[model samples]
Target: MSTAQPDEGTDRATPDALLHTRTGTEVTPEDVVLAAGRDVTPKNLEWAKRKIETEGVAALDKLLP
Candidate 1:
């Protein structure tokens, strides 16, 4: 599996970092990683969290695009 590596300095993010507690309908980072046959890593999780924070739920789209 191709796992992404985080650049130095940023705090490592958990796989569930991007998850929304109020809305129980979003696909989690773990699920996305599993479905893509990739390993979960702090960097990937961080990226996911960053995207969500910067782009709302639409981050999922840019995260791939």
Candidate 2:
């Protein structure tokens, strides 16, 4: 006879859980702006980078805040 074990690897933390673990100061507008420009889509990345450079970190509000 064999015993079945539950799969722990299948479970992953939700966004809320991830957020809770973050340091409040780490989620600043500057980080948001940089992240926005890092998309894999070439067009979006170019556009985002330009937006960040021209508009500054405030533009990240559309995506982060």
lDDT of 1 by residue, 1-65 (tens): 99998878778655665754334467566544444456789777765566566766554443342
lDDT of each: 0.57, 0.55
Q: Which 10 successive residues of model 2 have the least lDDT summed?
A: 20-29
Q: After superposition, how far is residue 9 of candidate 1 from its true place, in Å?
A: 56
Q: What's the alpha carbon RMSD for model 1?
A: 16.0
Per-residue lDDT tens digits of candidate 2, residues 1-65? 99987698867666643443234443343455355656356566667667667766545645552
Backbone clashes in model 2, listed as residue pairs: none
- Poorly placed runs, candidate 2 (over 4 Å): 1-39, 63-65
TM-scores for every candidate against the unseen true structure: 0.39, 0.36
